[model samples]
Target: MKDYDDTTWFLGQWGRFQQTVFFLLCASVFPNGFGAFSLVYLTDIPSHSCLVPDVNLTQDWHKAIIPIKVVNGKQEWSSCSRYRLDVVRNLSALAYVPGRDVNLTDLELEACVDGWTYSRDVYQSTVVSEFDLVCSDQWKQPFTSTVYFLGVLVGSFFSGQLSDEFGRKPIFFGTMAVQTVFTFVAIFSPSWTVFCILLFISGLGQISNYISAFVLGTEILTGNVRVLFSSLGVCLAFAFGYMMLPLFAYFLRDWRSLLLALSLPGLLYLPLWWFIPESPRWLLSQGRVREAEAILREAARKNKLQAPQIIFDNYHVDADETEKQPKEHLSIFHLLKTRNIRNTTVILCMVWFTLSTGYFGLSLNTSRLHANPYISCFISAAVEVPAYISSWLALRYLPRRISVICILLLGGVSLYFIQLVPQSLSELSVALEMLGKYGLTTGTALMFVYTAELYPTVLRNTATGTCTTVSRVGSCIAPFLLQLSTYLKYLPYITLGTLAVASAFATLFLPESFGRPLPQTIQQMYRRESSLKCPFITRKKPSKAVVLSESKL
Candidate 1:
């Protein structure tokens, strides 16, 4: 019997019906993009120093309380320490001058026992300011982002099975609501602990909605539209949302207000519940024949076409003859059932982990860039446009393995060289960092497409979800990785760069999947072989005769 793709040709592939679903689903992804990285602005460390007590003192005496220390070769007031209050009080009692009689350096220093003053120049309010998550609590700042990603990891793990068991539409709408409601609630969190808890829950919902929408689009659309929607539609919309985030943060400097602004947009997506249909493929897999038929009929009617009167007629006919055949329900463990499949799964996991690490690490590091954080973040988001376009075009033309390796290597090399850039030329360093991000974004786009092509349909979702879970492990640690700079300044970059390059080599071991049809069974996946000559640097095209022979097989 013909597959669903063949059977559904009459429903109109790229018609108005499919286009509506594609764009609306893509719209759902926009908020996720912003939400995923909002922590960057939310947790940003504004200029701060220990709050000096309000006392009538000379200008010189005022300066003495917050002593200047040379940091990174630049003299700046100490943020975590201040002159001992006893010494300052004694000097004031004596009515002595600050520099003439008193040696400020010789005086003991102490932590900000009273409170800290914050600079409102860049941000009106941030989590750092609201909770005083600086100095002793500075570690908590990056921990918040880590907690969010841990939630994403949990979401990715269960989203597939839950959607597969329930239905894509319900899971999609439910997760979207959870993400929106929790995010808004987080704004009112009374403590950092509460905010982190809400943030983690929001993450679970965020990834669930994202992956569900993605799967729904792929199942509903056909041919090039599926590729476009997955690679360009949702991906581009995500980039657009990311770009909009810095703009929103730039205008709304208060973190609570910015979060409110981000969460409020979910109201626009509520209408999609009425419009986006359940995935007919998923419905059929669940043996919900009537539901699948109804959706197909609606799709045909909207596209101004006619579906087969008996939608399941062919499926029933095929099932009747194959009644004696045992149906296989593959799980994640099935991925390691064979040597080749197990190897592919391991390599893909490494690739995914490295890709996610580099992507989030560079993205979160925008504040470290020399330029204004808003512009730096905007540039980071903007660079994805060309990077994604390059990825989309490369997937259409170039060999998949070659594209993955080249971009990974490029990103890895650039990240390593970023250490060589002199701090004096901050612009040059920022440029190299953005360039590395470009490569990382391209690799991210390519890996999703390549993984889909690599696995058999029987275990594709299982494999993909598993890889995504592994990637989130990297994402969870990414913020902590940034915190490592406290121990050694370039540790984060060196770590991510090394992983990217190592994963590039790992990509070389995986089979080339360009221009290949997806396998439908574990047997087919095992029997598959690399068609590309070198599977490394070479990109020779197969002859027409060879292509025809392979198709005949």
Candidate 2:
């Protein structure tokens, strides 16, 4: 059969057919963007303190029940602990002040017997507020995000294989339905435990839909357009969607309403199933020649181009031979089988891990930044637009290795210096943190196209899926990393910065892929040495005259 790229004979590359598919696939990514990070707002811990029960007492006596505790060297009302109820009741009846009538230091402390009262200045309702997920129960907040990411990890591991075995279209539609339905269902979750379980199932479909769309685009498009679509097109859509999330959260105020707003858009995507065609290349690879031909012709007709009467006529291969071909089950193991492949796989996974940690770490920490959470989130998502644009340009013009390294290095440096910004200038600290986020976001966009170019088509999905699965470990750790801020304010930034720097160095071992044809098979990766080296660095062959003179011929 004719190569998929040779479709120029019957259809135009940048014509109606490709653009139609590209935009629709990108539209699907809009929801995936916000869905990935919604936990930041949904589970946010609002200002909370121990609830005081009904009692006839002076205002001072009521104030004495909840004692102030030192946090970060500053005194704030304790959320978890309170003064003994009996002592407080007796003191209130006597109109006693702690320091005046009783020794304040001698008052016994006890855990919050009454449920907490949450401040509703920002959030009207949240899982943290609704379920009292503060103080002792605070651990559950991060665990919720971790559980969601665990689902992503499991989905990423298997989705690619399932897509490869079945058609991309089926997995795409299936996951989209799962993502939409479950996310909406989660709003009515009976308990925090049920909400988390629904979140996990939603998470499962989220990454799978994204990966399915990504692979479909890579397989269907050709040359620079493919790079453009992968780096900027879908990524930009995601960024825009993420930017809108703050507006939703800001207006909704209630977590359940915000979730409903996030999920309701998925209904608009159902019609996409009819518009998107299956990957014709996959059909050909499966020896379904007639089915593949129909798709190509339909594409040509849609593009308003002339048709070749016989599309795969010149291609000659026996159907029996195709059936007899070895059905090798490609797995992540295939990535580690060879020397060069093993080295490449290890480095790529590390790069993915570091990039993801920085991205999610910053994304999740917007609430902690000394600014309006809505504004912080908007700024965070807004920077990704320019980052993605630069990444798209770099993918086209610059060597992939240098592009990734420079972006990551900048991110690492920006993160490292955040601690040096004086607390008096909280704005400067937020700006520096955003600068680091910009760098990491750029690197993230670049890595998607870079990894796709590195792996051959046969193993491309498996490799990308494996790398993304490893990256989820970073995402899963991000919540806990933010939790470390309670111990040392700058710990998460320092940790992410350190990882970004280390991964930049690790990226040096990877070969550059710029203006070179994508590897088609595992064998091609092993046989081709020059294809794998830095494009800007090369050894010069000796000139013929110099060789003759040196030989004294």
Q: Report the error of model 2 at residue 74, Å.
A: 2.9
How much lDDT does candidate 2 score?
0.82
Off by over 4 Å in 1: 316-330, 456-458, 529-553
- lDDT for each residue of candidate 2 in 83-129, tens digit (9 for 90 to 100): 88888888878878777898877989988888888899989999889
Per-model lDDT: 0.82, 0.82
| Superposed Cα deviation of residue 44, candidate 1 (Å) | 0.6
Candidate 1 displacement at residue 303 in angstroms: 0.8
Q: What is the C-alpha RMSD of each candidate to the true structure, in Å?
A: 4.8, 5.8
Per-residue CA lDDT of model 1 for 16-93, tens digit only, reads 899899999999999988899999999988889998888766677777799898987899988999988877877887
Give all TM-scores, in the order shown: 0.91, 0.92
